[model samples]
Target: MLHKTELEYDANNHLFLDAYHDDAQPYLGLLIDIHGGGWFRGDKDKDADWATRLAQLGYEVLVPNYRLTPQVFYPEPLRDMDTLMTWIATSDFNQMPIGVVGSSAGGNMAVELAIRYGVPAVSLSGILDIDDWLTQHQAVEAAPGDLDRFNQQSSAAINQTGSNDAFYKWFVLNYFNQRTDELSAATPVHRISATTGPLFLANSLAEFVPTSGVLKLADALTSVQVPFVLNVLPGNRHAKGYLDDIFSQITAFLATYLIDQRPKPQLATE
Candidate 1:
């Protein structure tokens, strides 16, 4: 009963998004699932399965393709997200409650959008604090066999001597074009304010993305009094790797804010 439609969002850039939903059911809300590939690679199709699953749950899911690094730099991808939001606001689904879920780089953007629009969001292994992440990597020495293990598991080709943390740092630098000064502005942990919406953040205790950043963001959200849930799993899995195990919790969190909290129509007292 699931249906999917691909629609263009940015014609000039030839960017498009896939919409997934069940035609037989009323949409509970709109959930945007952003794909993640360290901000340098990845496409909307990467999240098709996740979108379909969400759609089956009675939510209209949107998976968008945004510009990546090398072709574009900091804020360009975020700008594309802005365009998508604008498009949604004018579309037929404008009035529906909105929530976002993303992995890694996409998770970072989800938090950004949540901060911008005050909508509920979930970030899975998001690189929340770029500056702190780089600093931490620089401060610590890689453990024995860490580099080899990372290279063995990574899909992207990495030098034999490179650790997972180093590879992550390379991509982050690439996304920012090495403008270290600008990293703070793009760091979601630093951007949190009182207006930021509820967020469910998850990260593995020993994942390549590092748990330190997630903890920092959690502390920052606390300081601002923004409601959030931090789930730190046990393993080296990053982002989508541990998603299946925690998916139910993710959906429950979304439903709490987007569906359960929504105002219900009053019944007539005839």
Candidate 2:
């Protein structure tokens, strides 16, 4: 019943996206699932199973591969996402309601897109406040036995130095080209407005990503009176690491905004 097809969104760059849907039934809405790899490495295929599961629930899902850092920097990947959104807007599915869900770095972009496009979004362990995080946390090496605990609880691969802070900061610097001045501008917490769409944010209590950024984002969303839900589970698992436990709730939140509240298409009378 589920079908998947790959379509090119950026022909010039040879980038393609995988689309998933059920051929037997009308889809409820469009959902974009963005994969996370600290911005330098990751493929859409990594999220294929997750997209298939959402498609089985009556949603059309798209997973796109974006340009990564080193070869590209901060806004290039974001531009790739913008291009995908533009392609969708001009396609046959333009009339369908849409939403977005992402993990880690992808989650950061999802929140930005939700604000940019006014669509519901879900973020799993997103790095929401880069500027604040950089200021508050240092790239310290793991203490005695800390590496073992991090390895036990997290899905992230430890960098060569065995330091969580150093590993995370490395990716951030790569994405930004080591420029710290503009981080606040790219930070989602600093960009929230009254027009921003509803958001569902989930994070581990003490993951490689500091929980402080998530809380700061929540506070900003509250200050703007935007609707949002925050779920902090107990562990160090990041992003999709704990996704299975909260997936049903994520879909339900998306359904409330994208499907339940939208007007169903009516069949024409003969």
Candidate 3:
């Protein structure tokens, strides 16, 4: 069964959450699905398909939307997420094994949630470092009106092999609220430490968010000996395209922590 309702995760943010659960199968866990529109666009409906699929896999899927950028800013969205989780803790979903599946910007939030709260998470073609992303785009002479195209060229950058797609660049720029210096804090790669939780990150070689950021995250996790899996696929697709073939693999990984609640794999020191 699926239902639509408004849940106020924060006093200032009321999320439109589309929830799905299968009655035939016992509920395994709560999986929050976040959509990717680069923090400025997107809504619950965008991720409804993925959410319902996860629900069919026996987990309750909740796809929620938060405040967007230029209007709300970076930390505001993160704060809204914090409120969402806090509300969940006090509601019917309290303490149930929780996980997150996010695409792009949503992936960034999901990873932050996992790092902050110690929950398991998976990111599909997410941007790990916005600063690095901006730098890459600038190197290609991309600007505010470039759309998904790298330069002022008529062709979309995403259509070209090895080129990146960053349609949300303007949104991200506004998310910083004109204070670009704050981006360092918003960049997940910079924040990742030894305490970060189990993560499954998959990226397509031909997409926007550079594979370099993913590699950097993997390296940091490895340095701390954190248990994680980084999958770099050979393709020129973005978020949803990268997800089509990896659905089963992701569900299995979610099952490891959400259903089985496996003990955290110890690092060499731990």
Would you list the C-alpha lDDT of every candidate in the order shown?
Answer: 0.82, 0.81, 0.74
Model 1, span 1-270: residue lDDT tens = 888999998888899999999988888899999888778777888788778889999999999999998899998999999999999999987989999999888899999999999989999888787877776667554332233322122222322222366567777888888778887788887778998889999987766677777798789989999888999987677777777888999988998989744769999998
By lDDT, rank the candidates, best first: 1, 2, 3
Residue-pair clash count for candidate 1: 0
Predicted candidate 3 versus true structure: per-residue lDDT over 46-159, tens digit per residue: 786787788777887878878887568878888878878888889898857899988877888889888898788999877676787776666443334333432221112333
Highest lDDT against the true fold, candidate: 1
TM-score of each: 0.88, 0.88, 0.85
Pairs that clash in candidate 1: none
At residue 38, candidate 3 shows an lDDT of: 67
Over the stretch 54-162, how does candidate 2's per-residue lDDT look in tens digits? Answer: 9998999999999987788988888899999999999977888999998888899899899898889999888786887777766553232233323222334323222
Q: Clashing pairs in model 3?
A: 165-208
Model 3 weakest 10-residue run by lDDT:
149-158
Cα displacement (angstroms), candidate 2, residue 29, comes to: 0.3
